[model samples]
Target: MKAIVTPGPRPVTDPSALLDIDAPEPVLGPRDLLVEIRAVGLNPIDFKVRRIREPGETAPDILGYDAAGVVTAVGPEVILFKAGDEVFHAGQINRPGSNAERQAVDERIVGPKPRTLNFAQAAALPLTSLTAWELLFDRMRADPDEEETLLVVGGAGGVGSALIQIARAKTRLRIVATASRPETREWCLDLGAHAVIDHSGPLDEALTAAGERAPKYIASLTQTPRHFEALVRAVAPQGVIGMIDDLPPGPFDSLKSKSVGLALESMFTRSGQGTPDMIRQHEILAEVAALVDAGRIRTTLTEVLGPMSAATLREGHRRLESGTTIGKLALTGF
Candidate 1:
């Protein structure tokens, strides 16, 4: 099988950060399914791992999470799918990933692919969708009917697009997304954000002048430290703040006064921790697939790299690092 594997930990500029290699086809095991991967979505974490290869780990690490593919074979215990079943999933992070022509993924976390979407389009949804779903529903404990104002920082990115749509679908929360440019603002609004605020200046000031009330549920997707102060001001007392960004070392001074509940989302935690509800990923993803088939939610793929290769993957990562991509960057067909 042909694969793009990271040779070693190095700067992303180094050619070895991602290298094309030919390896033996992976063998499937019990409780696993062999998927012929068709499309893969690139995330920032892929580049982060490429640049910071863990010590004592071997070279040629496989580093992808979001994939849409067809099941070519199934293990003995796999009753959910058969050969030639189309599937899409963000499989367990600790295992060998979906960057190769074939991957063996646990059946517990895999979901049926949305029939309405193509491979690349379907590939763009899993990782971000899971993160947004967990952040909104699990961490914040949001109720479907209780009216609340919601804020999603960095609304133009992959997870933000999913966050906007899922919040609208699953709850009555009125969502306001922060985007600095006209294109991004338009994109957010198109994805179901009730209002868009420019993140260039004070977010609080923008909300105040726009007559938007402080949000009770805030999803901070980026620059957590830089936005913490404004979030404290714009977030209502006894509100909820769910962030996926790394908490920088700084004075958490405002947290003391705001009485806001803080929570973090790491979608990998369930699989990483081997929790009892590990199969819930398959459940949520299957529900989301139904939503996609019903046309209740749309794919967030703004850019499609036609095929998988070293150059295309690099461009995807570079564009994501530029922080201007309106949605996900998806690469299809090996």
Candidate 2:
């Protein structure tokens, strides 16, 4: 299999940061599907893993999560899919990932690809969509009938883009998103945010200036540490804040006074821990696909940086690390 692999932790500038190699095929498990990867999406997790996780000495580390592909074969215990089924998923974080021409992914987490989208577009949805859906509906338990305000931080990024659209499609919340740049602000509004504020300013003040009430729900998609105090001040009393980033300890004390609830959402949790409800991801993706087909939600793909290769993936990582990406980046073909 032709694949892209990381040697170990290295800056993207180093020539050895990512390597193109002909790797051995992945071994399939009982519930696994052997997929022929057609398109792969890039997220911050891709770069973060490449930088931090050391590869095993025996096998290369393949770093990718979002992928759309066709099942070439299925393990004996796999009941959800068979040969020739088109699928999309953010595979388990603990496994070798989708950066290769072929990958082995558990069938329980895979969903049928949206028929209305191309492989590149479908690939962009899985990871971001799952993260946003789980954070808003599963973790926060937001009410669809409530007209309360929901604020989204970093609204131009991949997860934020999906979050805004899904919220608009499924809930009645007054969506307010934070975006500093003109382009990013417009992007959020285009995706259905009722208001856009600049995150460069104090969040509490930004909400005030934008005429938005203290948000009953806040999805802190990035830089949770930097925005911790402001978010604490900005949230409505007894409201909930859902987070996906890694935060340093000790911020819990501040939320106590306001009676604010904190919920941490990690889309990989179920698969990583072998949870009983791991199949929920498959259901979520199926619902998302239906929404996509109904034109209620759309793919957040911003760019397709040529085919899958070490050089292309390196450039993708460089752009994501720049912290200015306005949506998702994808690469199709091998």
Q: In terms of lDDT, which candidate is strongest? A: 2
Error of 2 at 136 (Å): 0.5
Give lDDT per model, in order: 0.87, 0.94
Predicted candidate 2 versus true structure: per-residue lDDT over 231-295, tens digit per residue? 99999999998999978468489899899999999999999999999999999999999999999
Worst 10 residues of 1 by lDDT: 52-61
lDDT of 1 by residue, 1-334 (tens): 8888777676656666677888667767787999999999878777876777673363336778899999999999887899999999897667778888999898878899999999999999999999999998899888879798999999989899999998888889999999999999999999999999988888888899889998999999988888888888999888988999888566767776878888989989998798899888888899899989998899999889779887778777777777777899889967
> Could you list the CA RMSD of all candidates, in the order they appear?
1.5, 1.1
lDDT of 1 at 63: 75
Off by over 4 Å in 1: 55-60, 250-253
Question: Against the true structure, whose TM-score is highest?
Answer: 2
